[model samples]
Target: MTSSSRRVVVAINPAASFGLGSEVGPALVTTLRGLGHEVTSLTEPDFAQLLDATRAALREKPDALVVGGGDGMVNLGVTALEGTRIPLGIVPSGTGNDMARGLSIPIGDTEAAITALTAALHRPPRVIDAGRIAFDGGRARFACILAAGFDALVNERANRMRWPRGRSRYTIALLIELARLRPIEYRLTLDGVEHVERALLVAVANNLSFGGGMKVAPDASLDDGLFDVVLVRPLGRLAFLRIYPRVFAGTHVTDSRVVVHRAREVRIEAAGVVAYADGERIAPLPVDIHMQEGSLRVLA
Candidate 1:
C-alpha cells in the first residue's frame, strides 16, 4: 500500500496498564488523523472477538495495525496477522510493554509514537520470529516470551495485585512469591538434549525480556530462528535474592547456577506445573514449543 493510502487501526485495551487505555486512545487517534492517515480505535475485546476485528481490518487491507495495549494484547493482534503482509505497529500502554521496549518503540509519549508509526509505515516491513506452545488438545501462542514454574507464579500474583502497576507491581509480586516459593522437578528435551532438574524457573524466550523488564534471556534475538532457553537451577533463598536483581541489568546469565541454551524446539513435562505464554495461563504439564522464523512482520 502507498503511504498516502495507508490506513491505521489501533486496538486499545481499556483495562491494560492500570486503565490507561481509555485516556490514550482518543489522543492517539487524533494524532494519527492529523497526519493525514485514516485511523480506527477499538476497545478491549476477548481473544476471539479481537481476532475477528483483526481479520476484518485485514480485509480492508490497512497499511498498519497499531497495537495499543500491553504484551498480551500485542500477542493477540500479531497472532491474527501472522504469515500475512500486514505490518504490525505498537504503542506500548500495557503493564509489561516488554515487546515494545525490545523493539525500541516509544512508550510514554503518544504523539512521538504516532510519528514513529507514520514513518515506519513508509518503510519495508521486517520479518521476526514468534514462539508457539502446544498441548494435548490445542495450542497456545506468544509473540515475545513464555515461562514455566516460579516466574509463572510471580505473574499470577502480579495480575492479582491492585496497588502498583507495570514493573513496580511485578517486583513486589516477585518478592512476595520468593518468600514461600519452592522449586519443582521437571524433565525437558531441548533441541535434542535431554536433562532433568529441580528448577525454580524455566523461561523460553523469543525476545529478550518479560515480567515488565527482567531480562530472562539476555542474548535472545527475535530474528535468530531459535529459542533461548533459560533455566534457573534450584538455589537457596539467599542466593536467589542476590541473583534476582542482576536480571534487570541483563547480567544474570553470568551466574554459575543459571543455565542458558539455544534450541529450535523444546519439550517440557512436569507433574504439577502451570505454564504461561505472554503472561496468560494456558496449560499445565507436557508442553511443546517451537520457533516460527520470520513469521511476523512488524513496523520496527
Candidate 2:
C-alpha cells in the first residue's frame, strides 16, 4: 500500500438524526476505501454495542478513527481513543454536530464534509484540549461542553421519554424543564479557589457550542489548557426567555446576568443536577473536570 493511504476504522450510529443521515456511514466507508485506504466499518444495533465494536477496532491500531453521527458519536470516539495518538475523524450526521461546527467542519453538507475529512487525513491532524470528568462510577472524556444545570435537566428528561420522537422530543422536554426551572446553589472550586453561588445553568466548555449550535462560550479556546466556564445567574421566566434566544447567536454573554470563567480544573457541586458531556449524560453533580491540554488529535 502507498504511504499516503491509511488504515481507517469507521464507526457509525444508525439512529443519527433519527435516521435522516443513514446514508452517510456507507458513503464515508466507500469513499475512504475508494481512496485506497483499508476501512473497517462498524454499525451496531445500539450505542453501547457500537462503542464496544469501535473499542475493539481501535485495539487493532488503525491510522485514524472516524465517527459518523452527531456529538454523542463523538463522545463515543473520545472514550474509545482516549490516551491514544490516533486522530478522530467526524462526519456530522447527528442532531447536534456542535463539535464539527466548533472545528469549522462542514455541517449538513455530506459531500463537503467528506471532502474535508479526506483532505485532513492527508495532512497532520490538529491537536485540541479534551475535558475529562471524574465521577463516582467512572471517568468520561469529552470534546465539547459539559452541561450541569437547566440544560442538562432537559437532556435527562428527553432521554427518558420514549414517545414523540425526533427534535420535537427535546422541545417538549425543554418546556417541561422550563416549567420546573429554579436556581441551583453551587459550590464551585475552580483551580482550587472555592465559591458558592446561585445559578440557573453552569456550562463548562472545552469548545464553542452545544445543544445544536448554542454558542454558550464563544471565546472558548480549543488548544488552551482551560475551560470557558459559563454561568447564567438566576432569572425570572420572562427574563430567561429573552436571554435564551440570544445564546443561539452568542449574544447572551453581553448581558449582565451571564458570566464566563476560565479554569484548568473545576469541581462542580449542585444538588440533584446531572451533567451531560457531548450530549451523553456523565453523572450527577459533584463531578470533577480537568482540561487536558492538547489531549485530543482530530482530523478537522
Candidate 2: worst 10 consecutive residues by lDDT?
Answer: 13-22
Candidate 2 per-residue lDDT, tens place, 1-300, comes to 799999999998857534678799989999999999999999888998988898899999999999998999999999898879999999998878999999999999998999999999999999999999999989999989999999999988999999898789999999998998899999999999998999999999998899889999999988988999999999999899989999989999999989999999999998899999999989997999998899899998
> After superposing candidate 1, which stretches have Cα over 4 Å from the reference?
1-3, 16-19, 44-48, 157-176
Q: Model 2 Cα displacement at 248 (Å)? A: 1.1
| Top lDDT prediction, candidate number | 2
Model 1 alpha-carbon miss at residue 176, Å: 4.8
Question: Where's the lowest-lDDT run of ten residues in candidate 1?
Answer: 14-23
Inter-residue clash pairs, candidate 2: none
Each candidate structure's TM-score, on Cα atoms with residue i matched to residue i, is 0.90, 0.97
